[model samples]
Target: MKVDASAGGSSQERSAAKASDPTSADAADDAGAKPRAALQDELEKLDERLKKLYEPIEKIFEEKLKPGLAKLPTQAQIDAARAREGEAARAREAEPSRADLQPSRTTAQP
Candidate 1:
């Protein structure tokens, strides 16, 4: 935007003017930034507090639950087993079941 020197010419020269301009959206953002920064600082403090609170619980889980988790089959192992079973299951689906293959006992008269 071209402006006369009386209206503050360059962008760098207009920084103070824009900050003070209540009609400008930049002014509202500038006004809101201080509180947003304060809120960000407060949230960081709360996060640190929660991190301290959960530290012991996380350690206990790592010690206790982790051993049990290690004993369980890995996801890859589980997936391989499922894949093997899937082939068998598909074959079973294609073939008639044992009951369907058996002869019916009812004798019919012609």
Candidate 2:
């Protein structure tokens, strides 16, 4: 049965319509209860499973990898190395082009 959208009635009207419709009422009731609980339980299980799966990876990064990475050059050292490389690149660009050193060939008149 079609609902009166213009009436602006309470939700009771919608529920009443649903109650009268045996197929819809049963479907609505089923949707409201067991499936929702089951979905929540499934989500909780998945969350726990994901946590369990990542625990070892987290531990490896925290315990094994972090210390090794900590021993590497500090940020200041890295910035200094980058600055030296940039200076070298600028010096190379400032040098005279090799083509400028070559002798020019003059065209002969016929």
TM-score to true structure, per model: 0.42, 0.46
lDDT (CA) per prediction = 0.87, 0.84
- Can you tell me which runs of candidate 1 are displaced by over 4 Å? 1-27, 75-110
What's each prediction's clash count?
Answer: 0, 0
RMSD to the true structure for each prediction, in A, is 10.2, 11.6
User: What TM-score does candidate 2 get on C-alpha atoms?
Assistant: 0.46
- Residue 68 miss distance in model 2 (angstroms): 1.5
RMSD (CA, Å), candidate 1 to true, equals 10.2
The true-versus-predicted C-alpha distance at residue 98 of model 1, in Å, is 27
Residue 84's lDDT in candidate 1 = 96
True-structure lDDT of candidate 2: 0.84
Q: Candidate 2 regions off by >4 Å?
A: 1-26, 74-76, 82-110
What lDDT would candidate 1 get against the real structure? 0.87
| Best candidate (score: lDDT) | 1
